[model samples]
Target: MSVDSDIISTLTQRAKQRPRRIILPEHGDERVLQAVCRLASNGAVVPVLLDAPTTDTATIPDNVEIFSRRSDAAQWRDRAAAELFARRAAKGTTAEQARASLDNPLLLAALLVGLGYVDGGVAGSVATTADVLRAGLHGVGLADDAHQVSSFFLMALADGRLLSYGDCGVIPDPDAEALADIAIATAAGHQRLTGAEPRVALLSFSTRGSAQHSKVDKVREAFDIVRRRQPSLRVDGELQFDAAFDPIVAQKKAPNSAVAGAANVFIFPDLDAGNIAYKITQRIGGAKALGPLLQGFARPWMDLSRGCSADDIADVAVIASLLGD
Candidate 1:
């Protein structure tokens, strides 16, 4: 098997060993139902459907549990609404607004995760990315140590290596501090998901002092912050993409750097660079991009691409289950 397949197989096996209860809010989507069936069959997760399937019920496995807000007891809904209000009260969310927000499957799914009803949630098939992330932020909130929420794509290259690309889906223009947070969070996530210590590279247009620009300075400052915050981490930066990925370029440009040319986790300067880079890697470089999976959240919640397939949903569900671990 290919290394990407092997990695996914291992992750699925690990998730099956101790299956998590995961919510799929977009039950109306055929792909979500198919993924539910796959998860049930594989024993990778206990797939919880947020509402009754709009399609034929037999397509859903018997192991799947349905939680319909319409059919559920009023007392429980009230409790959930209260919890939502409490969580969002600081955002000027009125009790009525919190109660109404529960009508949204995305928000409800996140609330379920936060209330410990499920281990995690996967949505965004039909919902926009902003709605999905807003639900997670409002309902589940951030990890205690996390200053902000960031995202990473686990790129499984055809060459049999796994790397992480960060801030690709969130944070349009991160300042130095936010960039540092993205690096730290993505590094931890890389270790947790891939079982490899992160060798992080803060990518830039310049290699060290080869060029000068405000953007380069931002990357360098972020690199310094990462080093200060995570002194033991193997990290280097203001590196060009080639210097970060190719040993030959590293030898020429940044020979003494600990993480040069061997970076398993790459932190981009902005969302434009990160998003574009991961797509190019996936399309042209023939890498499997496993995420834009969210990091820095207290619980695991995934945002799927609108174009994601059933297999993609299943893969992400398994990944989310493991992340909750």
Candidate 2:
């Protein structure tokens, strides 16, 4: 079965109360706006385009709320200056410096959220990952259940089985314990996105001691830690991807394991394998990859790489809004 397209449409209809703020950072493009417009038309969010006034005005949608309205060279600029001065005096910022940080649109957006003008932010695509990550790490508090922020992708497979692969979007080269942390966060994300409790197999090249590798040893230890600490979860690993995914292969390779032969989540050994597998699956095999979806933050925040499409923005917005509610 396909994932519901109305995941966005329905969320849009029900999101009338306290709609989140989706801030478009500098050079955040048209395709991005098109996606925001879909959410706007459906009433799911307050879309505030961060900087639309300059030469790039033609790129934005005609009806979208833009920061352009605040700029007029003579009249509004002075008013902006005066307000900046007063606000600076009130907040102990120097007049010269009132405009310093705010000149950076990220600081502006952070001010908006901190002052409670909006619920959250969706950034990246046009902005750098460092830019978005800095804003989030410095802006939002950690969510109650999470100790540290992390990322995950809820892979909506073309075949009807769902899978999640992660920390690809964050936490590079995780240790055994950190991988266990990734597994737990990834499991929660799988449940949140697909309404499916994960049966996660920590994937690697070797299977059940048939071959030896340093990577395999790390995954094996991670599995034990995960099993002991999070007993409610169904997980096993150090299996190959095929074993993790194929019931027959899993049954034969890693016999009599509850997590084997019926796994829904596949945690990769490291960044290289996870990235390559998903990229190959998407570009070569044509799987529908929805996220390097950011999970475990206190507020719903997602990042868009420069390659993101209008639909990608829309999907992420839906997922972020779903998590917020």
Candidate 3:
């Protein structure tokens, strides 16, 4: 989800309209259950525990749906090899293909979603990054129109500012065009998660002609590409962190950038800055780090770190429900 208040409201509307029954991966832990419970009690979709052992049910909410993981391991899809090969391969599937797919945990989970055995897959607390992407990519697949499935983080400043920090958790160093695409996606995601019509600031050390180098030039070029891609969007770039977030600093530095100080969404030029900025804010600055939103998907799938609390699970569950089809 996004930090934009409007995006928050949008999720609220989704909770009211089409609540889902998300599928938890096999033997998924207690923390995850707690998260599911928080959202369900508050009118989000009911959680459907999948592949979880029977002994574990005692700790889960009584009303939540539970799918026997043991059964799904063999029953979700039969035409292929894995019982849960998603709806995408109901026909023309080979056992060898299914076997290879199941080798990937993400793919295995995605198969369940693909076959409609589950509404969505929420893993990551117990799997590797490779596992998460491989499954989601194979099972859910990308939107026919999208070229890639990148990631984003939903960050909220303690001072009541909310915005997205992106591709930090996914791509290491995106090219100018990839950066441009990420910006557009992040802005749209901001609207979806926070309901804010984004005024984006593409942040770098260099603000509008203040400096010129490969790094600065990248930000400048990406900004141009993003603007061309989405002319209706209000985005500008090559801005310093201060100029992007502090209006006074922006006026003094750039003098003419629409994004200076008026910005609500910031697009980082690279991973080093984006990842470092968010960590510092989350750790030292006392801000709430809501998400690595996992945007650019056809379905409402999200991930969790194994170290996360039950509260984290519940919040993300609500977010996934809010993004449902």
Candidate 4:
């Protein structure tokens, strides 16, 4: 099936309400080009095309803004360079190297977002995850109190319901602390995207000690960490899938949890489970998976799958715009 139109419409409307400036680094990619056009045409965001005003400017749509290398030169020669140089210098980049790096679309786009010239950025259509991660960390930096960067997928159920499944793309394995961070971050994202209070569940194979394993202990510890750190947050843990999603099973397994059986956000114990679960929901259960969207960034920066389609890029752009709000 196709992506849920209702989900798209909701995000698109949210984006249009206060359209934010979004930088698209891979303007050379056909998918990026198509997606940017769609975003601009619908007024969801001001699509800023980095590296596009070069010789290939003729193909770009007028509604989109092209931020060429030449335009970035003014910034590179001024205050932006000083800040960018400071960020890169610790990694052994010299003043000259930092200046040159600013001309590259990825770094330049990140600089714009950092400098508050734009609200957020969307890239990775033609870049590696490493490249995107490096640029984002080096430039935009992490959100306050975030110990590590992680990711989540906004799963749109066949019934038009939305769920947040986290740490599926970035963290391969997390200790209690990182898992707590993922839970908190994903809960915030879940609330922001859906406008509903998040009911977060830290997932595991066991439900309230029904099964015994080190893995179950890890999830339980992470749940405790979340509860301690964010006491006001509605969260529960060590829940099996049925306990987390099925009310009858939840009553039997985790009767006291406010989050059980009504969880809109799920934090899986490891990447293996999170990744497998999201794919299973998408492929077998026929859900529309809209992310693997990075979280815990000071300014929003979405890293697309290299295999992403134009529609995927467009959807992510809208999601990025929503982050600005």
Best by lDDT: 1
User: CA lDDT, every prediction?
Assistant: 0.90, 0.69, 0.71, 0.87
Clashing pairs in 4: none
lDDT of 1 by residue, 76-185 (tens): 56777999999879989999998998888888889888878889999999999999989998878888878888899999889878899999998999999999999999
Regions of model 2 farther than 4 Å from truth: 1-21, 26-28, 44-100, 110-117, 144-149
**lDDT value for candidate 3?**
0.71
**TM-score, candidate number 3:** 0.83
Model 1: CA > 4 A from native: 2-4, 69-76
Better of 1 and 4 by TM-score: 4
Tens digits of lDDT, candidate 2, 196-284 = 77898898888888788887899999999899889999998888888877888877899987788788887887888788878887677
Using all chains and alpha carbons, the TM-scores for the candidates as numbered come to 0.93, 0.76, 0.83, 0.94
* 1-325 per-residue lDDT for model 3 (tens digits): 4344444455556665777767666344666766666666776667776544545566666677655434444555453245433443667666676676665546666666656666666777787667777677767766554567777777776676676787667777888887887888888777777777998888887877878789888888898898787899988888888988888998899788777888877788777878898888778976667677676666767777778777666667767665556
How far off is residue 29 in model 1, in Å?
1.4
